[model samples]
Every structure is written in structure tokens, then in C-alpha cells.
Target: MNISENELKMMVLKACRGIGLPVAQAQEVAAAMAASPWALKQLLTQLAKPILTASFDFSIGLDIKNAHILRDFWACADAAYLASPRVCIRGVSSCDVTEALARYRGVSVVAQGEDLLVMVDERPMLKPARCEVAPDEWQQLETYAALTYVPETDASRLVGAGAGLTDND
Candidate 1:
């Protein structure tokens, strides 16, 4: 399926949020996915992994030994963007997604062994107007995004869900 960059971002944002990522982190992941739509598979993989708590230190950067890629990568990117010229993240399972995110954040990433070195050097790229996505991947993303929706119910309708009580107004 072919979708505009904005559409992809919104879908990814909803998917990330559906998986329980905080709004800010979800937005970051969405922007990264939009920047590199080809990384959708990696995004899905990362989403399926167990979410783990990350440890960060100004002096030590981010250590993701037991952490999931979705949240910790962005956190490390933010840290690199703000404080250090370069930050090292260990045990990154989704290098492609991490690289995409680093590009989105205008940072450079170099993988060394099982670790990633992110530096605040690169400039963010402009997103393409349209990108091709595998139909299966798009469907999977839709499935995840669907978790954000509220199921239709009579009570919800009365409260003004969808078209609410009337659409003629």
C-alpha cells in the first residue's frame, strides 16, 4: 500500500500509543517510522518484544541490556541531542529502527559490535510525499492502531461518538 508520509506517521503514532508507549515517545517513534517507512517490519518486531526499563546516565549514556528498543532508543537520542556530543547504547536489537530514528532526530548512528554510537551531527531529512508499504505490514500496523479505537456502543453514541445522535447538523 502507498500512503502519504503524514498518514504513515499518524498510523505509526497510534500503533505505538496502542502498545502503551507514552505520548511523547510514541510521537518520536512515529516521526522516525515516517522518515524511514521501510523500517516498519523492524518497528513491529520491536513492538512485540517485552518492554523493559532502561537506565541512563549523563556520564554513561544509555544501557539497554534488558530494555526494549522503542522507548530507550528515543531516550538515548534525546540525551545525545541535548547533552553529549555522542552517546553509546548497548544491546540494541533493532538497529534499522534505531538508525531511522537517529536520522529523524538529525543524529548519526554507527553500530559497533552489539552497541550503537549516536552522535548529534546529521541533519534531518524531509519526508517523501508518498511511500510504498508492504500490504501485510500495513495490515499489521492497522491491527495495532485499532487498539486505540473505542468500540461502538449505544452509550458511546449517546455521549457523541462518531456522528453522534445526528449528522445533518
Candidate 2:
């Protein structure tokens, strides 16, 4: 289905949050996906895998080993953008998503062998107003996002959900 950029961002943010990512990181992923909607599939794939955290050493340049794209990529990109001009990221397979994220964050990323080299750049990213997502992917994303909601129950309805006993307005 076709969705607006903002819709895509909010959905992605909710899905990431539902999958246990912190608010800041979920926002980062959401913005990246909105900037490059084609990366939504990659985001879904990454969410299914276990989250792997990588330590970054910015002594010479940012060196991140075994960085999972969903959990570690945006953090790496932020660090690389702020502290160092270059970053060496290894053990991530989503190069296209990495490149798209770099573009969104105004950085440059290149895949060499099995590593991604990220460098700060001044290029601006172009975002489309609407994104076309496959139905299956949308369903998967919705499944993840639904985890954030409170299930409807009779107790909830009695408390505040629907019309109360005195429905005279």
C-alpha cells in the first residue's frame, strides 16, 4: 500500500520501539527509513534478527566491529558524523540500507569487501512524499507495531475507553 512519508516514519518508529529499541534509536531508524523508504524491507529483516551491540573506538577513526544494522548502524552513523570523519564498520550485511542511512544523515558510505566505510559528507537527501510498501511487509510491520498497544478489555472500557453510564453530552 502507498503511505505518506510521515506515516511510514511513525509506523517504523512504533515497530522499532515495539521490538525493544530505545526511543532515540527508534527515531533514528524511523528517519532513515523515511528518507529512503526502499530500506523498509531491510529494517524488517534486521528487526527479526537478534540485536548485536558493537563497541566504537574513535581513537584514530571510528572502528565498529560486528555491528548489526538495526541496532548499531544509526549509532555508528551519529558518532561518525559528530566525532570522526571516517568510520570502519564490519560484520553487517545491509550495505544498501547503510548507504541510504548515510545519505539521510548527510554522510557517505561505501562497501568494500565485507566492511562499510562511512565518511561525513555535506550532501542533502531527497525524500519522496509517498512510499509504496508491499502488503506482506506492511502486515509484518503492523504486527511488530501492535506490540506497543494496550489490549482492549472490559476493565479498560469501564475505566475510560468508551461511553460511560452517564452518556448525556
Candidate 3:
């Protein structure tokens, strides 16, 4: 429960890699944390409310048969996008779950084939959100699954540009 400041920074760095954050961007965030860990932590704590939620349509076919794996994979992709509001892609196939699920989230697919693509929002640091749903939610929806995405409540700690910044920025 009580992670040392150094540990927290390392955890953030690891998470950045997990979500495929560009090296430079990841370093920038890590540096900011190293400079002012308390500032970032307070910012995160403040933004911890009024969670964002999204539902998706997963009617597309999948080669993977394990529902749990499939669910976790989809959740990771969705969380990546929600966390960054950018095109977070996974899988190699042109038409894999990554593309199908992204479309369900109402985000535009900038490119596809070999790997799914989405335009990076480059907006100021959005917190990664937790995706949750009841056990029978997927079954009840019949190919459609509703996930509640609650972003990190703190806004001040968030790094990155706000919607005002363009990808070029």
C-alpha cells in the first residue's frame, strides 16, 4: 500500500511501457514525477472522481477462444485509448479485436493492416481508467459489452497537452 517515491516512479515507467507510450514522452513524464512526486500524487488524488465510462460492441469474430483472455485484451486496448485518448493499437492482424473494439468506442481508425492505428490525441495527461463490468454483462449483451472506464480523478498531475495541443505540438 505504501510505495516509496522511487518505487512509484518506477511503476509509472513500467506502466508507460506497457501502454506503448513513445520513449520521449514516457521520459518526460518520468522526469516530472522525479522532480515533484508529491505534486503529481496530489494531482492524481484530486482527479479521482466522476469516472468516465464507455460501452463497446464486440460482435466481430475473434481467433482467440478463451473468453477471459479476450476480455482482458479488449480491456487493455480500451484502457490505453481512454487513458491517452489516442489510437492505442494491439495485435498484428489487419482486422483483429483491436480494430473492432476501437471502432465500438467511437474512435476513428487512422490506419489498419498489419497493425491497427489511431490518431494520437496528444491532449493533456488523462489518467488511466479502470474497466469493469459484471460477470454476466457480456453474455447478456450478446456480442456487445459495456465497460465503465473511470479515469484517474486527479487532473493536475496529468501531463501532456490539453485538447488545444495538436499532434505536431
Top lDDT hit = 2
Query: Model 3: per-residue lDDT, tens digit, 89-144?
Result: 33433333233333334333444554344432333432322223233321322221
Between candidates 1 and 2, the one scoring higher on TM-score is: 2
From the highest TM-score down, the ranking of the candidates is 2, 1, 3
TM-score per model over all chains: 0.85, 0.86, 0.23
> Candidate 1 lDDT, tens digit per residue, 53-130?
776656565444565667767767777778665577777643678778877888777777887777786575747467
Off by over 4 Å in 3: 39-169
Give the clashing pairs for model 3: 47-153, 47-154, 48-153, 48-154, 123-161, 124-161, 124-162
TM-score, cand. 2 = 0.86
**Candidate 2, pairs of clashing residues:** none
Task: Give one digit per residue, the lDDT tens place, for model 2 in 92-134.
Answer: 5545567667877787877778877777788878574688999
RMSD to true structure for each model, in Å: 2.5, 2.2, 19.9
Q: List the residue pairs that clash in candidate 1.
A: none
